[model samples]
Target: MGIRDFADYLGISDRAISNWEAGGESYRPRAASQSVLDTGLARAPDEARARFADALGVSGPGPSAAAEMSVDSHKFLPVFIGSDRAHRLRTQMTGETPPDWLESCSAIVAHPHAPTCTLHVFACGVVVFHILQPRKPASLTELAVWRYRSYASDLPWARAKIHDLLGEHHPHGPNPEYVLSLYWLTAGPWIGSQYDTAMRLLSTPSVLVDRSAPGGPVPLDGAVEESLLATGFDHPDIVSFGVRGVSTGYAGWSGVSYAALSQERSLTVEELVSCELIVQALWCYTHHIQQRIEEGSDPSTPDRYGWRFLRAANSRLTTARAQETAQHCLMREAIMRTSGLAERLRAAQEALRESMG
Candidate 1:
């Protein structure tokens, strides 16, 4: 088929089809578009299919379009943990009896900075943790550390903040019931907030003082080197060190990955601890806001209404302080969502005020 005919057949823009035909190193069909292309090839005449497949450099319709096109799924295998193992770990970390519903839960660890690290605790006690990464894959140990830290340290602060803001007898410390309830309500936005925080930190400019380079500290974008400086991160064995914007091959997600020259050193414990605190704080604040929305007591409030089902599963309390907390949460979310440089700066200023007060 001609480009226009193929575009029409695939129900996509002709430009996209043209990009596909041009066979550039970066162009690839979208996942949905790829599926359509595969289906069209499957139904095409054998000769036509062979021509199209040859143009795209694929064996046939059976293989992934990513192979023919310069597409990447950014997919990774999940580290599965049975409910019993998760519960035992939780108990060991927090010294609390895990909720009965934890028996069917599984944890997935992906890229630490990716917003995909989120927990979903079902009413029946089944929890699924989706861990995503921006560039490299995360190990099971890294995932476990994040989980343990969230439960042991982050959860208590979240609970206390909620109780203090709402002026309720909410459970204190890392009680599994309260923790799970809170996660169920706030995990989505909280996870996003954590990712935003990491990105913000990564975006900061910094100098990498490579010992091998006698020329003094070299300047680089902090975002690329932030992952390298992270604890337990193994430096990629490649020798290349430069920045290039690469397509993640996934729609709506694209960024630059830094190729850093490997050094024989790692981030200090204090530096790692500081970075972890920033991440933990973002999650805590978001959780606080989610809790306030739940405790707003007015079903008409949009945030509260949206989370009604989750609220129903947990205790409800309301107060003037809780409303104020909701306002702060809204402000934080707004700051995270801001786009323009000036707008973001203003949002950050306002966030400072919110945090101080």
Candidate 2:
């Protein structure tokens, strides 16, 4: 959209728009004007939004026909710190008790630096940090691009935060990597059969976003669904975990993502977040065991969190309770498979069992 056209679309004067643009990156939009800009972006046509996002040099929302979807981003950073270290760290943290699912397995603490960040210290010698960033993205492609672009900063932030949280208790700490991500899609633009397509693309953003671009990430094409519909798209990492139309989700290696679409009943955000916590914690736990085996060492932990704990965790993850909703089970399994937790759990269980012998 041209300057005057965009100004008129926003129902604002051209000179004001010019001033804002002339101010460029340094220009901070007035606090009150932020809502106005947000409203304008929300009401703008998909085509115009795409153009705007492209001009900003980022992967944009979906194609012209695709509706804008609201997504709140969640980042999971998991690392192993050993059971003894986790116990010592908990004494330094002032946080609430964890939920029922994680109460026995892990200790939940708030990240001191970032309000939106929380740290989960598991008894199994792994810690997962949960960072929440609310976003109104046009498409999963935008999220994929946003995630990678910020990863450089996110990793360093996690490392520093860990050191601060652990204090001088331990001089050595394991490096934490980007374990996974989740998007609680509050409002979806797709309908009926389109849910499958959205879930598929959500699992694999590389399909539309080009992450290897010169400057930063950009969209591969203006239209995603059209191209996907033509040839059909699927990824081994993508796992569908919801019924059609009602509630749909996809879990992939990068993250577990879900959208609540049920009219009769909707799954709570707390429910989804809790599931992600379990998935991420388990992924971290298994990664520690895997790392030990690779280093040619027998995994060892306190008696309570030894081979028996792995067996119990495996059952907790692989088994589905009757009271839980189908969506819950589907999402859990999807995350498990995508993270390769099941395989790792099995291997860990066997290795630890042999150690016991």
Best by TM-score: 2
Runs in model 2 with CA error above 4 Å?
1-67, 96-115, 168-172, 191-195, 212-218, 223-226, 229-231
Model 2 lDDT tens row, 104-207: 23334454334477777765566777888787676666666777776667777777777777764344666777746777776666553465576677666667
After TM-score superposition, what is the CA distance of residue 18 in candidate 1 from its true location, in Å?
Answer: 7.3
Poorly placed runs, candidate 1 (over 4 Å): 12-140, 170-357
Give the least accurate 10-residue stretch of model 1, judged by summed lDDT: 243-252
* Candidate 2 weakest lDDT stretch, 10 residues: 57-66
Full-model lDDT, candidate 1: 0.30
* RMSD of candidates 1 onward, in order: 21.9, 16.3
Q: Count the backbone clashes (under 3 Å) in each candidate.
A: 2, 0
